[model samples]
Target: MPIELPFDDEEASTDVDLKTQIIRFILTGAGSAVLDFGLTMLLQYGVGVSGGIAKACGFVLGTTVAYLINRRWTFRAEPSTARFIAVVALYAVTFGVNVGLYSWLSHLWSETVIYSALAFVVAQGVATVINFVVQRAVIFKIR
Candidate 1:
């Protein structure tokens, strides 16, 4: 009693392992987060940038590494410019959440960079959920 769609045959042919995908995603994401956090600290404290600016810049830098590796290596999708564009659009949407939450939380906590980073973590957590779903379905068309 299952509905057969246009992609049922295609989906059946692939037979991808969902658990492997999840594990790869987590491992790759951990590497990307280290890049983000390390860069954020360097930009903010080492270079005198503001908390919001540092996190924003880090988000861009980190996501660049993420998209390239995730698309090419992790998911092993056929590269598409349209999918890259979708990623940038999603990043733009998440950018607001990242900066806004970081600034708001930092203000409440006496402007600690640690607080800002924690806030960025929360914001990126939200973005991560959206990114994984979209990447698997729309970007990679993975089953």
Candidate 2:
């Protein structure tokens, strides 16, 4: 006798390796960070927004990019309000974590630009890990 899947076998590959998925998310996020930092600087320099305000604007932009990428490309989640809310809540948690650490670590580096870059890396890195956990356990879990 042969085993039968509950769903049709025509579905996309379900065995995407966890490690690969995380790496893909990171790479996508890295691309998004460029937009984040670039927009932050443009707002700060050209528009003269304060650091905190500029960071907030950039974060929103970057997070939008991340959400679209993660949902459509990385996780390929089915559309649902509960899943969307979970992603937002998870990001909100990571947002505070990212901002706090970025502010603290920005002081560690000499050049402000360099400091900002490193802060983005560190904060985004932490957020990425948290996203993986949340996405795997809650957000993207098939139920």
Candidate 3:
């Protein structure tokens, strides 16, 4: 028997098709990542904030932007208190993963912009995959 993938299903639960949704999600993620990374660098290097705290601050702001755009555009979802709660819960999980990974990975190398950026990218990449999967299959799935 062949294993089925969510994106392969023709009867999608979202307003947008899975392929289109993935594309939009990637685009949205790119923009969000820029905001997240830039803010993290500024706070950590420019303003002398601690690494984990800076990462947490950036993740919050970036993910907020992502949720707003994704609801209106990517998933075509309307605002709902239940959905909002779900998203916040989901973000909270990813927040720990993203920030924790960044903190751990950054310590693996000497403090420098290049090393920090690589660490950020690694952590962000892991969190991004988790975000897309959960948002598509659970939170934003049309009921």
Candidate 4:
């Protein structure tokens, strides 16, 4: 049975078509990834921060952006404290997976910005898949 929310009766809080949701998720992810990549590059190259540190900061920023958009636009759900905290916990897990993959894969590539971007992309892809599935089925499911 679907869980009920206080605002469930509102049409705005209901799920859209599955394909539409996937498209929105991808679009939202692309925007978030741009922010993440831009911030990481700026901090790593311009500010002299370590790659791992820069990536971590970028991940946090990206995740925050993703959550806000996914909550309102992608998932079309009313905000709940428990759900928000659940997203934080989910991202915390993915952060380790994303950063670890990025860091480990860095050694396999040449020392260039393109190579770094490639590594980040690979890690981000993995995290993205995991995130979408879990968020859609679990965290942000229509109740």
lDDT of each: 0.71, 0.72, 0.86, 0.85
Worst 10 residues of 3 by lDDT: 1-10
lDDT of 4 at 54: 87
User: Which candidate would rank higher by lDDT, 2 or 3?
Assistant: 3
Clashing pairs in 1: none
Cα RMSD, each candidate: 8.4, 7.3, 8.2, 5.1
**Model 2 vs truth, CA RMSD:** 7.3
Clashes of 2: 0
Q: How do the residues 45-113 of candidate 2 rate in per-residue lDDT, one tens digit apiece?
A: 668876566767787889878777766556655556777788789888877877667667766665366
* Candidate 3 per-residue C-alpha lDDT over 45-124 given as tens digits, one digit per residue, 9 for 90 to 100: 99999898999999999998898878767887656678888998999999999999999988988878899999999999
Candidate that would win on lDDT: 3
| TM match of model 1 to true structure | 0.80
Weakest 10 consecutive residues of candidate 2 by summed lDDT: 1-10
* lDDT at residue 139 of model 2 (Cα atoms): 84
- The Cα error of candidate 4 at residue 27, in Å, is 0.8
Candidate 2: Cα lDDT at 138: 77
- Which digits, one per residue and each the tens of the lDDT, describe model 4 over residues 12-106? 56458789889989999999999999998999888988888888999999998888877777788777777878898899999999988888887
In model 1, which regions exceed 4 Å deviation? 1-15
TM-score of each: 0.80, 0.78, 0.88, 0.88
lDDT for 40 in candidate 2 is: 76
